[model samples]
Structures are given as C-alpha cells and as structure tokens.
Target: MTRNLLSILPVLALCLWLCTAASSRLVKRSDDLDPLEAVVSQLSQTVAGLQAEIAALKSSKADNAVLLALQTQVRSLQTITAEHKVAFLARVDVDVAANAPIPFHAVDFNVGNAYDPLSGIFTAPHSGVYLLSTQIFPQFAGDVLVDLYKNGGIIIRMRVFDSTSPTSESTSITDHANAGDKYWVQVNVGGHIYAGAHSFFSVTIVFPDS
Candidate 1:
C-alpha cells in the first residue's frame, strides 16, 4: 500500500500542474481557444478523478488496519482459552485406607496434567471456577464416609451403608479455586472403599478467572 501511494504521488502532482497551466493558457489565448478550452476541461476532470481515487484508497487502508487488529485480538483470546482448559476422570482400582486421599489409580483422562493419580490430588493449573465430583462404595459395607477436600479442608461429605450388599454414593461441588489450590476425595471415617469402577473422581474447569 505504501509503495502504491508513493508511486501515485508523482503522477498526481504532474496532473495538478498540467491542469493549472491549461486553465491559465485558456484565458491568455484567443486564436484556437476552443482546442485549449477542451484540453483544460479534460485536465480538470482527470485531476478531480485522481483526488477521489486517492481518498478512497486511504479509506480502504484504514479499514484494513482495523480488521487486522481485530483478528489478532481473537487469536490471543483463543490461545488463553486453550491454555486454561483443565479436566480429569479417575477411578480407584484398590481399597483406600480411612483418613487418606483415595488414590484413584485408574485414569480415564487427565487433559492438563493437573490431576495426579499417584497422590489422588488435583492441583489447579489456573484460577477458575471448577466442578469436582466423586462416587464411592464400601466393599464389605458396614458403613463408609467419603469427604471432598479442598486444600485439605472438607467441602462436603457423603455416607454410604448397607448390611446385605455394597452401597454407593456420589457427590459433587462447584466453586472457585486459585492456581495451585488442591482438591481430593478421601475416606473420612469408616474403612476401605470398594475397588473398581464403583468409586470414581473427576475435576473440570468451568470457566477461567478473568
């Protein structure tokens, strides 16, 4: 665009000079004045046409600059959204001791590497609103207590008990957590949780903190 403008400037200046000279000669010359008058008229029209075209090009350049800026902003937003994404699904494959974080060793997926199957803990990678959930059942089933912990503080708890068969219970919570805050599902009071698909835990980011 800049090169085009530079190239056009010289032509525009020459046209203005020719138009002015023609107009002056039209006034001074009486013999063959009709030819001179025609030339002046043509030069005047060409100068006007060039001016309008330059104005239009300037307007188009401004519009293009604005569009490019908007596209850059959108790409930046998309990168942030992708970086803030967090989610995990894990399940306990062995009994967990009471008063300990359930080591959900069987992982279905952990998108952002926030959830550690080794420790059964999810450390937030970004500050955001999150959804945390779990389901658990005692293998022998006298009674069991499952607690959802956030940074070692109990957020909620569930109790499951059955005399004849295993009883399962599920719980979920949604709350805001800062980056590096921890979350885990734990056995609070009663003994071991049943191994297998009956016990599961999950964490997901609902939205990123702006």
Candidate 2:
C-alpha cells in the first residue's frame, strides 16, 4: 500500500497543479479562451472524482486500478488540449484605397491558413458560425467608413469621423459561413488607416456546423 500511494502521489500533485493554473486564467472573457475553459472544467471534475476514489482506497487493495484510472484521465486531458485550433488576428499598417479591400498585411496569427495576407480575405475552412470583428482608425482629420463583407455582400459597417485627433471605430458580427465562403473588410467612404496596430481584424469559429 505504501508503494502504491507513493506512485500515485506524483500524478495527483501534477493534476492539482494544472487545475490551479487553469483556474487562474478564467478571469478573462475571450473567445479564444473558450476551449481552454472547457478543458479546465473537465479537468477540475476529473480531479475531484479521482480524489474521492483515492480516499476510498485506504481500506481497499485497489491500488493498481486507481493508478490505471489516473493515467487514463491524464491521457484524455492531453488529447483534448492537442486538438486543432483555428483562429486568426491580422492588422493593416498601410493606407488603403476606396472601394477596395483593406490589406491586413501584418499577420499575427493564421492557424488554419484561411486568411490570406496578400488579398486581405478570409475563406472559411469549415462550415460553421463565426464571430468576426474589425476596427478602423483614421490617420488624419477625415471621415472613415468601413464595411465587413461576407461572400461579396455587406454584413456590418463601421464609420469613424476624426476631426481633431486620431480616433477608431469597431464593430463585430456573428454570422454563419460555409466552407470556402469568403469574408473581408473594405473601404466605403475613406481608406486612410492609422497605419499601425490600431486598425485590425479578427475572426473565429463560435459554433461549428454539426
């Protein structure tokens, strides 16, 4: 029994540490953190159940069974975290032209290769509901109007009027897209971006098609 307890002690300690680390990151409300939060919830429940089972092993000779269960649970958690993640955040640092798509050349991340930096377009890799957002910032004192296009149709529009200082406007839309469908941001009224990280775009799958 002493040897078995020693063997399982390290596994229990590692699981407890992971739970604490994951719990600390739950304060932020971000779309990208959704998957991590789900996994954390599952791990927390698993840890609780394992603790209960370990307590019951004090009077039973089920040490091998308990150790096997812990190993299986740990493997399950590893697999969950290793799944493919699809998301991207891109920003435009150069000036844009009117009636043209804003080329977000600076790609911070492109997990699924759905976003093309050369043409400033996002093609869906999977059929699902997506949450898309964009921000427009004017470099000079002028009016800036931007449109979010889904498959060549306007879905969301943002307008910013900067008379004295640089200002930005942002908006988001939750819509459905099929695989290979395109989404992009275009300049409707003005095309002059602030030329920095202030003007940006991001998209992520919220609910995949089942």
Candidate 3:
C-alpha cells in the first residue's frame, strides 16, 4: 500500500507541472494577437472615441440652443420695457396750506419721468395709446365736477354728489397719443374738490406707437 501511494504522488506532480506550462504558453499566445485582430481592436477604440465626441457635440448644441433662446427672450423683454411706461399721482393735502396750487401735486409713485409733480401734468414719452384714470374724493358734502384733459382738450368728466360725506368718483379714457402730448386733470372753477390721499391721477401706455 505505501509503494502504491508513492507512485501516485509522482504522477500527480508530473500532471500539475504540465498543466502549469500549458497555461503559461496559452497566456503568451493570447498576448500576441494576430494583425487582423489588432486592427479590429484599434478600429473599435476609434469608434468608441468618435461616439463620445458625437455625444459631446450634441450636448454642446443643446446648451447653445438654450442660451440662444434665453438671449432672445431677454431682448424681447428689453424692447417691451423700453416701450412701456406708467405714472401715478395722489393728493395728500386737505386744504390749501398756503394758497390753492390750482392743479394737484404728486404724492405717490411716478415712473419713467412721465408725471411732473410741480405742474401736475403727464407728458407722453412715446407715441402710443394711453390709459388715463382720475379719481376724485370730495372733502365735504358738495358736488364734484372734474375733467380729464388731453392737450388742453377735455376728454372725460367725473361728476358726483355726496351730500353728507365724500364718495370716490373715478373716470378713465383710452386715447391715442403722440410723443410729447400733454395730459392733466382739471376742476371746474365753481367745483369744490377735496385733496387727500384717496384722490389719484394715473396714466399708462397701453399700446406703444398706436
């Protein structure tokens, strides 16, 4: 039995050595690829590189598209803003602190240099269709008569009667105007108007170059 085991061990060792040498030879053969296979591998790598470049180019085109769209939108907004304007004025005085200033003065927001606080006039900044609104609130129980004038011509009149108290009366007009056209609110000489924050005059450009 011992001699049989020793002989089997020698056969096992010889088999292992042959297997290891065969594996090493196979590894070297795999490392030395044929010319055709090498060219195919190179072509595969180039194709992968080209695919990556194509993907990058597509991504760049998408980014450029988004940037162009944003630029166009910004330009449109700029044009609209340049053509639009608004002015607002409200009276805050109750009586003539000194003497009646005739026309009411500015007490609230004014934009685009459209309204003049000292003259109480809105001169058009561009040729457009304008919306003019006037609000009147009397101080005492009396009749109110005020007119909205364009270039010294009356366009709208607001008439209201508050016997015991003051109620707000408002009127508006949409008028086509040219650049430098003048607009204002006028009260009749006999009309009694109360000046307070509730009274407002406003103008807005609704359609530019209309």
Candidate 4:
C-alpha cells in the first residue's frame, strides 16, 4: 500500500509542472498578438493621411491651370480690341486743274476760307502719320506752300520751290490731324501767271499696301 501511494505522488507532481508550462505559453502568445495589431493600425493611419495630402495637391494644381488659361484669354481679347480701332480711316487721291480756282472737296472736318487760286485742301480721315505730295505739269514754274490745320488753327506750314515745269514736292506729318483735321496748299505764282488751260496738279495720300 505504501509503495503505491509514493508512485501516485510522483505522477501528480509531473502533471502540475506540465499545466504551468502551458499557461506561460498562452500568455506570451497573447502579448505578441496585441503588439502586432497596434502596428497594423498605425500603418493604416499613415497611409490614409498620405492619400489625403495627395488629393489636396492635385486639386491645387488644377485650380492654378484654370486661372492661367483665363488670364491668357483676357490678354488676347485686349489685343483684338486695339486692332479694330485703327481700321476706320481711308486713304484717297485728289486731282486739281493747275491755275484753276481752288476746287472744294467735302470732308468730315470743317474748312475755312484758306484757299488760293492755286491752293487746295485735304482733310484727315483719322489721326496718324500722313505723307503729302503734289505733282505739277512742267509748263508752270512756281513754288507750293502747304499748311496743316487743326480745329481752325494752323499747326504746320512748309514751302517747296522748283524752276523746272514738272516738279514734285513732299512732306510728312508725324502727328497728323485726327479725324476731321484740315489741310491746304497754296501755289506761289512767283513771276509766271497761271493760265487755267496750261497748268495741272494732283495730290495723293501715300499708304502702305495691306
């Protein structure tokens, strides 16, 4: 009976040791699982934050592109507006019989009594540089005086003289009259009297070909 009891005691002790070892292993596994879960949660949060930042950056870039396009369109519109303003003026040519009374040509601007038998008038259609010229027949030797007037006031006066019968005189007005500006030319008879049949003259406004 004593031997049986001692053998049972040793078997009971071995069972107790095995139970303790199993409990320790279960605790260790639980601690490791908790840490792993925390790490995964932190990684997920970081990924989400990065995605939000990327979305914001894309939105900002799109807005800037739209604004730049609008500015370019505005500049183009301004350029077109300026071009339309310059097309209102028309260039023309006039012919006058030499030694004849000054012929009247109607224009947009007002004309005063600034005419000589040999002098003629031209009106500005718009404000810009104008090249004034006259061609005369060679039979008459005389000088021509050109006067530019604005609002009934004289702005410039120039003189050209040639002894040869056929002569041409030219001048340029950098800041020419605006629309309705008036201009006229005076023929200086000098020594020769102008015979209505023998003298002929013409005036032209020079322009670049479009």
**Best TM-score goes to which candidate?**
1
lDDT of 1 by residue, 1-210 (tens): 646766876776786587667667565556756676676677667657766777888899999999999999999889888888899999988778888888999999999999999999999999989999899888776778788999989889898865687788998889899999999988877877788888999999999988
TM-score of each prediction: 0.65, 0.60, 0.59, 0.33
> Which candidate ranks first by lDDT, i.e. highest?
1
Candidate 3 residue pairs in clash (backbone atoms < 3 Å): none
What is the lDDT of every predicted structure here?
Answer: 0.85, 0.80, 0.68, 0.44
Which segments of candidate 4 are over 4 A away from where they belong? 1-139, 176-210
Question: What count of clashes does model 3 give?
Answer: 0
Candidate 4 Cα deviation (angstroms), residue 39: 17
- lDDT by residue for model 2 over 1-210, one digit each (tens)? 546665776786687577668767668678866777687667667667666666777546577778889999998766644443468999986777778888899999998788999999999988888999888887766787889998899998887875777788999889988888999999888647766688898998876665
What's the lDDT of the predicted structure labeled candidate 3?
0.68
Candidate 3: 10-residue stretch with minimal lDDT: 94-103
In model 4, where is the ten-residue run with the lowest total lDDT? 84-93
Which segments of model 2 are wrong by more than 4 Å?
1-84
How many clashes (backbone N, Cα, C below 3 Å) per candidate? 0, 0, 0, 4
- In model 3, the runs with Cα more than 4 Å from the true position are 1-42, 72-86, 92-102, 129-131, 162-164, 171-176, 205-210
